[model samples]
Target: MTRPIFAATPVNTPVHGLSAFGDLKYPAGFKQFDYANPDAPKGGIIRLQPGDWLFNQNTNTFNTLNTFVRTGSAPPRMELCFDSLMSGSLDEPDTIYGLVAETVTISEDRNSFTFRLRPEARFHDGSRITAEDVAFSYDLLKRDGHPTFQLILAEMAAAEALSDGEFRLTFSGQQSERTILAASTFPILSKKELATKKFDSGHLQPFLGSGPYRVGRFSAGRFIEYERVEDDWARNLPFRNGLYLFDIIRIDSFSDRNAAFEAFKKGETEWRGEFTASVWATEYDFPAVLDGRVIKREFPEDQRPSFYCKAINQRRERFRDLRVRQAIARCFDFEWINRNIFYGLYRRNQSPFESSPYKAEGLPGPEELAILEPLRGKIPEEAFGEAVVQPTTDGTGNDRRNLREAARLMHEAGWTLKDGFLHNEKGERFTVEYLVNDETFLRISPGFIRNLRSIGIDATIRQVDPSQYQLRLIDFEFDMIDVAFSLGATPTRDTLMQFFHSSTANLPGSNNYVGMADEAVDQLVDIAARADNRQDFTIAMKCLDRVLRARLDWIPNWGSANRRVAFWDKFGFREPKPDYGFPVEALWWYDEEKAKAIGK
Candidate 1:
């Protein structure tokens, strides 16, 4: 096919739905998400054991309803309370469906975006959603929202309301690549609501929203519930079809996971997403399981890396060199941890982007080479060859080969064992301390600590309260910490900016706690977001994955490829989960008949 030529001042293209990469799955006016069960029943109650943390809140207990603010924890599923200009597709990467906005027009240069809101778009209070609301929301969020929300909207230079229902946002055209997808995904708040409420602090009052459900009832330290509105303004919209099925979604709070697990056995909770591998293997022997009233299931995990690893702080001079980091990494016996501690429930995770299309494996291909060629002198020469792979053990804790290798690497890095202590030329002993918050990590750390001890490193573990743990992490006051995060389903500029960008390296409370300030990484992050096509995106992502893996400051860990869940036999869900989502509570419809049968 021949391509057409464009004028010097390129014209904007109008699209019903927009995608960050290319081509949308659903064209304009598509009835519903193909992944949804259009005819699924909706009603009844679905009780869930409240997750330990709500979104990125610092603590397990929540004190306020305002998630966007920095003072308190957001309620579970608080995001569902308000609709955004566009909603993301669970099954696809970097795609968004129109919600309040009917259609979007992007300038040819990809610097400006205009969204025409649907005239019928209304808030839960029956007020029309206006362009002013969108504009105000942007300003409010950037000025007073949480750091995470601020990071999400960092690229927009300005926003304006042209008329009644048309909103326009212009980009800064700075180094940061801007995308409509980022703007669309943020929750749109009502300008009127903003004037009457305090958004920068904790509140017990109900939050104003424009989505299918609203806060129903809550006992601060005990439980929270969301009740569905039958006449929800956007219930029949293509983007919202077959979602929020439960009439009442109840989340019960427990002191901790152990108490919640006990409640699951006693038939108090309807669903449980189990994370502990040992519990999944050994538990579930109650009468309900024996009588077939309960069921256990596992769904495929998303392709993105779990980011679950031991984050070694390279800001400390001890872990500065790659050789030192690698030597410390070799001491971690992943095979033994999986077999004995995790009950053979996980696979060793390597690259930060492991298990995804972005995962870097084998050698760098031509596209990756294109990205790497410019950084030859800056990066390690070995990075151009086979991707780094962590050491393997024979499911045994005491492996002579790995220990010897660790010792050899340590020696090469100018360290030697002397009188049961690793000492440098200055006679300073090698010592490390792990700051942890959870009991599960407590069980896992002993093994690695033993390995470090064997190599003559004085290692110790300190358990801190959640509040203190959060404070320490914010201050970058730990030698090592266990951390895991996803770069989202689609790796965007925001992901890199928050996690690896040099500007954020020294920023307190930023995700770059590793203190890695490399120009090469920042460039790859920029290139990945600015790619013109999927092929370009893949090339950038692959190269970025390779470069990040080569850093060696991360001790690769393990995660299950499946979501371990067990629930009562009373709900139905769409088969074949989305590539980037596992929407059990959102998509699963309650079956009253099945519940009655189980009761009998």
Candidate 2:
């Protein structure tokens, strides 16, 4: 349930979590993860800010308590309520140890897996977790779970419960290592609860789970809090030991960031990961920060690489032409924007997998050409040259050379300047509104809007609430949207299918928001899927990056390799944070002396 902090970057790195093939970095009897302190004492009340930080909407609204269903937006960190069969180590890049399941054994052909549930694993009501419950949970998910679950389980044949303590999940020959990993990661629900309550409906009643925390008290759209269970099962499990220390975790609901910032300054919220760079650099002069009660830190990102790009809805006829899309990309002045708006904290990102080994650089090599040659006419010829690079403008906020090139591209796309508006022969003015959920874009939007206007394009910005935005996005009801996605250098087939395959291109709730449907993408993704080793996967990934750069439509944007985080000083964490992100919940513990000194 760890989602992206940004649009596409995963909150948890793949290597840090339960891996698909049980190829774990830790052995069977490993005590604890290197990132986790087995001896750390656990006691504290941690208050966190929820809702979408990318859009700055502090409404903190969550309508449905059932997080797995598609009815409404679920609260943040809803995944914490459920326990997966396995858990990942923060120190490793791609590995998983047993959690609910004590031991896992896979078939030699890699088509079947048998898991033995831990004897101590129990549900919230103290009923022992059994193989029947696992089978029932799989049945429920296949029948009425999220679309993602359906896609992930497409290759899974069945989850057969043989006894009270053991179950076997068999898959088709097309099953992937990533599929096995996903089959193990679902939140196991109580079969007894499913027998009494409806699983498909949106309700305020929390679903019964077996995790360390449970939903205690909540007021719709205002606030919700999770209380830790003292008798919670699996606390001593090697994978879960010394985690979830906070007795009470309260998610503060706010109307705006100003109110949230004031509450954090006053210690109403425990800590926040600073998203806005300017705010991190200039806005820490408050009394708490000046007095050293709070700390600001930057952690380098070591997981998948991601980039923010303005996604042009190609389903619309206006963007069907490649020249039009390229013209739009030419309009964005990344150099000027990074210098002034983003406070020079970001770098321009041109490839889908920016700054990673998978990123396509220079001309195609022999391995890449082997993949691209088959689809010569199917892909753009420009892809044969150097990878598509965005126009670089001197930081004067306006560059005449790029503007002239953009003008030519626009003209070639049959858009002529008419009384300050780009009009076609049919008399429709070319216009697009940037759809957003948060008003934070209003500050940096003027610059992009001004540049679009320079090319006689009628561009505007539209902001909506969080819930409405989610609905519209699911239905693909926007003209253009700026979205970021995480793609690693050697991503697994599970991720490649969701991100690039044509099979999920039109799925309503799938991540194919750009509606990309290209044969080359489908082929490249298949190559990545069927690859048997890392070298093969790397070749497929590089080929994917090259084709995606020329074929996919998006206005290139910026990226940040470091995570800007700010937190209170009372919490103690071990040295050597993971290369990907901060492991706050698992490793950070309450410091009695620091809290006393800070007077918390």
Candidate 3:
């Protein structure tokens, strides 16, 4: 007896006024200003100013948002200019508090979830947020949003309004706890306002958002200006209040990071994420830091994800053999790369879920063995029964010992050394082409290539422009490539499945560039997805991690211990959180008096 919930009449809520759903309450320690507080100043603009251009045309839809050329930078910038229904802790996993939603409840069976709308929540145009808007937002994103959006919600059968201010969304399968958290990404949009404007390629002009900031003006290629949304409904939400203290947020787009750094120094921008060692050690001897107009600080990041070595065309003919893949992993000189190019600013990743609760470390404990024993003959014995050895750095620059091991493994895989070249039984030399996007990788990858060459294997490095690199990646037209996969705040087996499963590999723009297809891994991911509770989910995820690590499907790279960033001292930040990245936009604010003292 499942039925789609629906509202019979269009609720004629005033567009420029607020309506009540129920009693409005703010989170603890949240003090609502009377819209007259001098400290909470009314009008000014804040500039985010990113070192990248907006590449995609569709900013209103999620489906094409990932395809946007500014994929690396836009999301962080847009985060300041939008609102999500739910907000997670700046500290721990599974610590989500309500934002746009007043209360979120999951049904006993876990197939359906209901979100009660906040009473006073309103869009930028001042239309009341009702259940209809939430349902419309879900429908639009599910129907026309990016493929990833659709794939993420593949199990969601329908969404409907259950009451005046409550909406229910039902999934086709047993809902994992992660599903509710994932809903936070689906920003709620106002349907009435959207219907008035012509959505060009799904891009909305004068982007109406219900967040702390509202888009004010845009100079196109130069900068997009945003002013604080005074009396913002979700500001007092537990995750936000006392956050976004700036009066304005301006996003200045630039083509180059170096130029952006120079702009920050010249007082054009306020912050920059330091990626180069030269700047890390040398930059910021300015009058700003001495006068407390700017502060230079380094905060350690826990659970920082890895920048991994992704295999392209995994289902393709050449990389089908797990032995060949393992040999390729053994060929890399991780020790050299960590010491030299990265300035030892990274740690080698041991598992896809490294640093998370799901990472399987040490020998299998009895409880873990119980889970493994049941799948004894179904999965590889090395996957369940063996201990994962810690990686070592051979004193020699080439990591000669590891190279020798790689050569031996390749040889055992029917590859033979002939005329100082390793060749398969058919006499084809074991040649691999490595594609990279940056100059740093061009310098770093050669060390590994040299190791391969020393072992009588041929490996070449191909450097391409960023655009060309992305094109090649989407086409799966490379042998080996450097890529990083991002997992959700709460790690799950779905993270592994999305990156290695056979089904995703066949789909375009999916993370499964590895084309991993084993019956056991597939079963583990399915079991993990259907897990009833947190404890069961963790057990399932750890089991999947053990299996994936043993297979060595991806050669792990190093993760940064801290987010290396440089910003004008006029802003302040809280202590770093565990699961979240630098919540810069959430925690940081402009020291207006200090900013005025160093007037532009």
- Output the number of the lDDT-best candidate: 1
Order of candidates by TM-score, top first? 1, 2, 3
Residues 1-600 of candidate 2 have per-residue lDDT tens digits of 322111121222222234432345675577766666778877887777642321112245777777776557666666777898776555554455678887777665557777878888988888898998998888788777776677777787889888998888888878655566556878899888889888863677888888988998888877788888788887776666767777777786665566777788889887776766677778888988889999988767656556678888877889888898887777788888788877888888887787566777899889888888998998899778898888789877777788788889999999999999899999999998889876667777777787888998999989887788778777778989988666532466666766566777777766676778877778778776666555666777778877778865766677787767777788887776775445465567788889999998
- Candidate scoring better on lDDT of 1 and 3: 1
Worst 10 residues of 2 by lDDT: 3-12
Better of 1 and 2 by lDDT: 1
Q: What is the TM-score of each candidate against the true structure?
A: 0.92, 0.92, 0.80
lDDT of 1 by residue, 1-600 (tens): 211111111347656776655567887789888788779898988887643343335434556677776555555677767888888888787777778888777766666778899998888888999999999999898788766567766767888999888998887766245345666778888899879877864687766788888889987756788889788888889876887788988777664567878888888888898878888888888889889898988888776555678888878888888888887888899998888878888888887776678888899988789889999978877779898888798667878798888888888898888999899999999989988877777787788889888988888988876556766887789999977776566777876787778877776667777888889888888888777666777878888878878886677788767878899998888788888776677878988889899982
lDDT, each prediction: 0.78, 0.74, 0.60
Candidate no. 1 TM-score: 0.92
Best-fitting candidate, scored by TM-score: 1
Off by over 4 Å in 1: 1-13, 50-55, 175-178, 411-419, 423-429
lDDT of 3: 0.60
Candidate 3 Cα deviation (angstroms), residue 440: 2.3
Candidate 1's C-alpha lDDT?
0.78
